[model samples]
Target: MKISAAARFRRALLIGAAALASLAPLAPAQADGLPDPGFQIVQGQTALLVTDPQNDFLSPNGVAWGVVGKNVEANGTIGHIDQLFAAAKSSGMPVFISPHYYYPTDHGWRFEGALEALMHHIGMFDRKGQLTTEGFEGSGADWLAQYKHYINDGQTVVTSPHKVFGPETNDLVLQLRKRGISKVIIAGMSANLCTEAHMRELLEQGFEVMVVSDATAAAQLPGMDGYAAALANFRMIANHVADTGTVVGAIRANHHK
Candidate 1:
């Protein structure tokens, strides 16, 4: 039987489509949509997100210490975040670190909001410009030493720096989407600010979020308890809120499938 040229073209198209479909699930969660609006985070479809694990937020000698030292110590945030990373690795889950940094140019803005102005004055999370690595080695912008193994390891991904409090200010959503992550297990510093902002924005973007409560801390001032305020919102907005132990157990249970 003689086949028409147009018929041969159609046959080629179908063959190409099937080949593409087979390559879609590169890292699991190959489907674009979430299982449901409310999601149960499993080993394959979710990532562990730790934000602003920078020295400025986690170290006692950091500039922001005067504000967060007590809370950070009391909450044991450093150790908890470390544990979360360890468990995520054990379960073979992808880990994403969202960092915060500002350059010299960031300080020169004429009109700044209260927190922005304050951060500039305090020199918090300050690293040299994108071109220079100065002050980044041991400065407040550096990651906590305890987490070096995890963050520096080739497997973990560090997303583009977030200038403001939310993931919208960075490539976080892009990285997550590309990796087929439909859910996030999140914990990090500054609960009321960065952590909460990430939660709010991720939820709005339709990613199910489970917060590790004790793995995050907030700066407490005389009038406001930052952690306290963030806790209320996390409980109400996040798909789930639990401690490191609980989340680690769940991750382990779901692993190796």
Candidate 2:
């Protein structure tokens, strides 16, 4: 009953698509005062925040696997994001994957005691330029490959942000601002932590934020409640809370306007 990596990815994507379809009907065909991509002078003004969809968070064998609970992994949400990517491509909106990249000697390794000990044991953070020893090209690299096909489509623009905190990337903020992006659609791993951080920061920076409920995950620990709780918390701060389909529908409707 073991699932292969490819199979897991496929399953997650399918689940996400199904979720998106269900929400399509609920979204309005048009909403007044909302920024519509169709009339917007700039193309790719809308940015899709694909946060930390890494193998370590998505793969069962990753270091934080059981600690954050099984739901934090990407296996369940990859497919949903794929559907969003399709919508973004059709709308000419820009997709950004905020990957968590760390060097062997990076200071990020010293944050959490457990993670540091594990990295030391695995020699991933060694000063001698040793790579991760957990196999399959490690989490970050593996996630990049898993989504390589999407990138090849030339619709999504990926960025590697090297910050321990989700909202700490100045480069990302600057890029979005430079592009005149006033709103952002977010989806990614560890909903309560990284996802929340990003949403808060984006809102604080004066960008309207939409959080895709089913497209994000949270720590798998008890009382986490996975997507449900994450969605509720996001609803409080974000401009809108919707599933992948609803967001895609909004984007499409706006694009066609």
Candidate 3:
């Protein structure tokens, strides 16, 4: 027996509905064609990429203190980054530290950019040598004591040290890719420099990035407000720009739910 024309149309419509239903769960669909524009902290696929959480940037007694101290204090950057670490730990998200450390030979380079020359001149983030896994103590290259427990050996994934600015100079991208992390939640020093560089590079590499704005600080200059400039760029290009509290809340919800 042959099927009726109306019956064939109904069968085709059912098959089309089933095909769409299968594809629906492949990726999230937003009504307005907007990327999930809300805070999305994917539990295991997203890792926290904190750049240069070191004494030179976060502590009062370090070399960059003169430049970044006031902003650090005003923004409570130290506590905010710590808060992010704590939440990531509780939520079981990978915490990757992309540190900046300069060795003795780095200062010997004859040619340097403005910030590179300035950092060498100021003796910022100067480590004795790169041969040791143990970082220096009470030095510009050291991790703030408050963060040792979290970033210590075997406790966290510390990517290769980046000499100048971004994750491109280090193994950060490699580590993230190896761990299947395609989304990064970033925070840490000099909002316009390293943190901004991380954001730019990660986006170029096709990863979705969210920046914790208040968890990072920047050096204030006579006319240039570094953090403000970074915040603007993050708002324009990042998948999301959120504060510490907002991030922490999302982390909790993602992990617990």
Per-prediction TM-score to the true structure, in the order listed? 0.83, 0.67, 0.84
Where does candidate 3 stray beyond 4 Å? 1-36, 133-135
Write one digit per residue (lDDT tens) for candidate 2, span 16-123: 989866766664334542322221223456678888767666666555556543554343566777778777777888777776655555644545655445544553
Model 2, residue 91: displacement in angstroms? 1.9
Candidate 2 lDDT at 85 equals 74
Q: What are the clashing pairs of model 3?
A: none
Per-model C-alpha RMSD? 11.0, 16.3, 7.7
Give each model's whole-structure lDDT.
0.86, 0.66, 0.87
Number of residue pairs clashing in candidate 3, backbone atoms closer than 3 angstroms, sequence gap of 3 or more or interchain: 0
How many Å off is the CA of 3 in candidate 2? Answer: 73
Kindly list the per-residue Cα lDDT of model 3 for residues 1-257, writing each as its tens digit: 99999999999999998987776675345564434354576767899988999988888888888888998999889999999999999889999999998888888898988999999998898887888645588788889999999998476999888878888889999999999999999999889999999999999999999999899989889998888899888877788888899999989888888
Q: Give the alpha carbon lDDT tens digit for every residue of 216-253 in model 1.
A: 99989999999999998887788778888988888877
Instruction: Report the Cα lDDT for residue 162, model 2.
Output: 33
Whichever of 2 and 3 has more TM-score, that candidate is: 3
| Model 2 TM | 0.67
Q: Give candidate 1 regions above 4 Å deviation.
A: 1-39
